[model samples]
Target: MSTPTASRQDPSPATDAWLVIPLYNEAQVIGSVIGAARGTFPHIVAVDDGSRDDSARQAERAGAIVVRHPVNRGQGAALQTGIDYVLDRTNADYIVTFDADGQHSPDDARAMVSAAREEGLGFVLGSRFLEGPSPVGPAKRFILGLAAKVSSRSSGMRMTDAHNGLRVLRRDAAERINLQQDRMAHASEIIRQLAATGLPWREHPVTITYTDYSRAKGQSLWNSINILVDLLFS
Candidate 1:
């Protein structure tokens, strides 16, 4: 539970904002990914969810405060760990959940933070299905569109993109959330939790770049079904 380390990247004047990157077995590109994130954020907490590779080492080398899990946990657990680290160890006014897989962009994160401050929103969700056509292919577009509809129907909110990983939570909202689901299903669980906790939320448009690596690591339709099952059982 040491204080999260600072990187050589230019620190934002608002020291209370912390970016938490939850990843497992992403060593191949975690360094470069963290380096890119450093361009916008200074304080970073990279949670290594028991990756067998050198993810923690590379994250450290790239100047991220590394938190290691003794065993592999789901993304939900990793995010909860990072958020807990921020809550317990730092006076983090804001916490942004950014992916280590390079699918997410730092610019969108900066915009979310700005929106949180200017609009005084407790939660800011990044939506890919907002204005224009998505950059993704037809299959992905259909799946994501369905996911958004399912999430909106389940949570009773006008959700544009349901399972998007990029999100910003104000400190109070961050503390109130309790993520019990440890896998990809946690995405839906998040929306449910927000609804239950009565946290004020807003959404901003964002893009999910489909790189070769991200494409390879993308979830299948079966995975989506499993997420639905988890949400139903919970």
Candidate 2:
């Protein structure tokens, strides 16, 4: 088995890399996740996409810069809002879009930022497929792996984890991402956009913990089929 990469500190200083977390109805996990991320990244921005629960308050209490939307928007929309906040509020050199759940690790967060800084890549994706401790079940893994392959073929990027949300993007590449779909398909669309724009991108393996809570919040098997159907039909 391949060993985990050594954790390297971000050489670009603390204020350059901003962690952007978009959440909806993740009150149960938001606080803990924010606290965990805060251990590594100082600038953590959490966008509450009109969650019905008290996710915003939890994030704020956990030391995240909370930005609340008035109505429930999709994950893609929430991500866009967070990106906008990063562009407007801070002079961030790199922006990392992290999940609100505990699937992503703080070690991987720092590594991703460091990779982006050192490698001069426009974006770096935390690929669960390449990374160890991938928590997805066999069936879901097969489906997602196949989808990622298809996305790679379509985008000509040879990406390992096209749909993983834990990713870091340079300021220019991130600002160029315009999410057209408000739903889960935005994951695939992002690859397409990056490919079309010829952005320098790389994928690094990271651990994914598929707890019962995260599984419940994740895209359903039915939703996967719906995403493809929407992409094909639209």
Candidate 3:
């Protein structure tokens, strides 16, 4: 993947962590998401994945540093671009992988970063099922649960949610991550690579707000099944 140049600079003070958001065609909610997150996390990098909407402009207006991909890339590629941007351009100690949609919570992200710092953990994965049942539909819940079990067996790292878009990785663990699966399969690929790092990691309970818009944009059952197959064969 080519390095994307930042569209603008973030005026916030240098912090210990940076939120890396993989932005696509989420112009409707990306601005508010970044605005709310900026209250807790000042340093945010939104990698725009060739969005045809106004996502890049909205993110820039919300005070986030925007990195634009010249063409449409998969989420994994967008995430890797954001990660590389943080590592190469900033001095942050932690990198948080946050969703561009308004599903993930800024509070959860802040808490995960706090846990990583307080517990000396290198990786913190967000799990929607850790604390209790999530608001997802029954079919989606079953699919995700099965995927998590399969991922645990294959990667040797037990996880309650395999494809959750919220995660915190310290600089060292972030450096070890090289996502080759440039699509939905990268969710499981991330677990496999992170497990190989032998870093201290744990799952954190996170709330996923499935609003009407996010629900409409959620992955389909067929795609979920494909991710399972990827986990099994990759």
Candidate 4:
């Protein structure tokens, strides 16, 4: 990984939380996403996973700390690098894993962090299926539901949505995470590792807005199957 580059604006002192975004080639919308998220949570670190486009520059211009990987590492490696950077460099008390795509709501992220702080919880995972039916299509919903059940059974933690990217981890809980799965399978690996930490955790109801852009860039059905396979084997 290259040395992290920061924008001119400093992190706001309004909140003690930092959002860790795994960035790929979302140059078209990354600036807007970062701008919107910074309104609520000022500190953001966008780990650029070797994007060929101008994503890193856009994020940096939008007031995010840009940490570029020399090559195309997967999302898991990007996330781990962002987490490690936050732990090693910042005094942030909470770390939030947010997607570079615009599917996740900044409001939901704020709520999760609030819930974690209010309840003295170390981990708060976003669950699309928590309050009611998720907005996902039927086939995708079914697959994700099945994946959640399998993850819950294997990890010994009942989760409604195991693959949601939005999550809040207190410093103590973040310290316990060491992701070896440097790919999409890290979603399940995260649950297993967090459960092993035995930290108090809960699922927060969250809304995932599946925009046309996000749908186009979202994980494919084949990739979902690969995640299941990885969960079972890894």
**Window of ten residues with lowest summed lDDT in model 3:** 1-10
List the lowest-lDDT window of 10 residues for candidate 1.
Answer: 1-10
Q: Go through the candidates in order and give each one's C-alpha lDDT.
A: 0.81, 0.80, 0.86, 0.87
Candidate 1, number of clashes: 0
Q: State, as a TM-score between 0 and 1, how close model 4 is to the true structure.
A: 0.92
- Compared with the true structure, model 1 gives a TM-score of 0.89
The numbered model that scores best in lDDT is 4
Tell me the tens digit of each residue's lDDT in model 1 across 1-234. Answer: 011122232236446588999979999999998998887887899999999999999999998999999999889999999999999999879999999999888877887787777667788888887757677666666776777777788887777787888999999889887888888878888887776667666778787786778766655555555665665566
TM-score of each: 0.89, 0.90, 0.91, 0.92
Instruction: Write down the RMSD of all candidates, one decimal each.
Output: 6.2, 3.2, 7.1, 7.1
lDDT tens readout by residue for model 2, 107-181 = 777887877777777888788877465666677777777777788888888867777888888998988888887
Candidate 3 clashing pairs, residues 3+ apart or interchain: none
Runs of candidate 1 with Cα error greater than 4 angstroms are 1-14, 219-234
- Name the 10 consecutive residues with the lowest summed lDDT in model 4: 1-10
Per-residue accuracy of model 4 over 1-67 as CA lDDT, tens digit each = 0111221333334279999999999999999999999988899999999999999999999999999
Candidate 2: give the clashing pairs.
131-205
| lDDT per residue (tens digit) for residues 61-145 in model 3 | 9999999998888999999999999999988899999998888988788877877876788889988997776887788788889
